[model samples]
Target: MTDPVLPDLWLDWCAVTGTPVDRRDEATLGRFVLQAAPSRKLLNTLRLAPLATAPAWPPALRGDATALSQLVHGGTSRINDPDVHWITRLRLRRLVFAAVLLAPANQGGLGLSRIQARGLTPGRLQSLRPVIGRTADEASCPACAVWSWLDVIGTNNDWSQDALRALGHHRDPAGGEVHRHERDDPSHGWLDWPDHPNLLPAIDQWGYLDRYGSLHPSSLSSLVHAIETLADARIAPARPASVEPVSAPPRITAEEEAAILARADELNARVARILKEYS
Candidate 1:
């Protein structure tokens, strides 16, 4: 059955349906997340001063297809298609990143190398993944883990991989986070970050924003369609060609072959005779 409105958190929706959050489209959560989104008000209310300058949700987010379409030319396309998914993924990613950038120094950015955002193995990533109430706190240090947004959405494909990895993060084999200069950073070296320093509180602000974006109907539906597309392509990229069996020619005996060769010789001789006679 189709769901009318998406739950406040992706995990909440997953829990109700008993489906993995990564495979959200399989849950049948229904049409679009037409309800509450850009849960920015929750983050905005943070009394911190550094976040006072971060950009707020874009106005285009609230309107209907027509208004949203104007934000990016393809925003009005069918929800199941890649265009609309792109619209949801990109706009939402930007929205959250902008908010993080504006967050109070303690809550958001840390001198920790932004490079920690890259090369996260899916296993380690899952360990860091956040649920509704616990999203921001999944990582021990919110500042060090500020780049979680990249891992949440980036690992799937080339475009997303590049966009998120561009903001790179790295860790030592001991799970210690490392910060390297922009010019020297390499994609190869990193390890699972340890849970130590557990000093920072949960990044509730980011958690709220992530759930808003991922649980939205647009994001979930696009994921389902994308999975189906891949499956369809694998099953049959095009119609399969039909095969027909052929009967073996009657076996020819040695005598029959000799007779055929004799016949051919006879015809050739006759033709040659005729040619000579004509000449």
Candidate 2:
């Protein structure tokens, strides 16, 4: 059965906010925004009312309903993307390395201090692709997606562009080339910079690498946004190019060719006359 309380609460929210009731379903309402701050606004409004608690939703809808409640009533957590153009390869590598270390143990992330002791080595990240992609898909969290992205593209411009295109995210045409140091080697891993600075800790419990740790907020926001966009993306296969047929045209009699040309000329003349009249 459809949960009546959610719709009623949504209606009440709409009435108070004067937002047009576009959708009454639970899922749409979960992501619904009104003037950009409806999540906070609706929650505050509901808090003032005498409602003892949030409505009890079914198993199918409970997840969405709970998420909506957390977003509006509890709080909304915003994770930004990392800026690639301005970011130095060293910092980018550090961020990705830290992410790998900070990934949950359940996801096969190396949360060990001994692994951290070995330092940010390219070898450490070589076998972590499975965990990264797995966590990203199953966690239903933006942080996981960020981890997956860091694993997939890291500091490689080609992979970055390809991944962005796959996710339907736009890369700036005039963003200019990314910084490349002479000794930088991406094949080793995102953390392979030997001479680069070590700014990140071996392990971050607060999920800094996923967020704005040493990186700029806008950059992190951009990376997260791109990964989130990747969720609904459907990459279609490239269409094959059309090839011209090699078969020769059918031979025609001289008289028939002449008649065809005459007919074409007559049609052209008729079109010209019509155009002249219209003009």
Candidate 3:
């Protein structure tokens, strides 16, 4: 799914506020200011002038007294309506904070950190799927969590280990195969990665079970297709050997490997930048 319209909304706000743009440090803060600008009067009263000027705001905004104070005193302003200022400031602060937390980070420049990355792994991914059955509203609930996990994988660029671990597998002590059978009932079912072709169907199934008490037929079909595709890709044999047999396997040039790594690194960096901005 594409990101929510909040970033565009925030951009509109920035245009109205005449806020300065800093490409380097203030990218996130610029977004916050634009997003929060609709409530400019309240923001002014709260003295959240710094938010208007901050290069990057925290991904989550807390509503404690300290936050309140920072919002009100951060910027300079001539408005002095104390009574109205305090009430509007408090109300606007809560509203803005809630929007920030609930909004999808990828769509904007918001993202989870390394610590947050740990919670968004595959094991946790399934737990969120059950919520989809509750209602169409439930789809987004699981999606948000799943997207967070994807973001972690995409940003880290460590598909072999981190990605596998996020998918609920760990190396066994005796051998290097993925560990299984250690978990309880529902989680135990997810041990075989190849069994399920893609993660989307499982996500849909989770939603259906959580919301409707049964899986939809179409959803099941989708899951089957995904699994078939995965299996086919995995078991497919490599291309046939050349007509003439060679003494040894062809060696990859250092330049070629370096180019591939560079490309991968660039892609990861781009993803990371987007995540940071939206976060």
lDDT string, candidate 1, 195-220, tens digits: 21211112222121232112333333
Candidate achieving higher lDDT, 1 or 2: 2
Listed in order, each prediction's TM-score against the native is 0.18, 0.23, 0.19
Question: How does each model score on lDDT?
Answer: 0.27, 0.31, 0.28
For model 3, the stretches where C-alpha displacement exceeds 4 angstroms are 1-250
- Positional deviation of residue 163's Cα in model 2 after best superposition, in angstroms: 17
Where is the poorest 10-residue window by lDDT in model 1? 71-80
Q: How much lDDT does candidate 2 score?
A: 0.31
**How does candidate 1 score on lDDT?**
0.27
Highest-lDDT candidate: 2
Off by over 4 Å in 1: 2-212, 236-279
lDDT sort, best first: 2, 3, 1
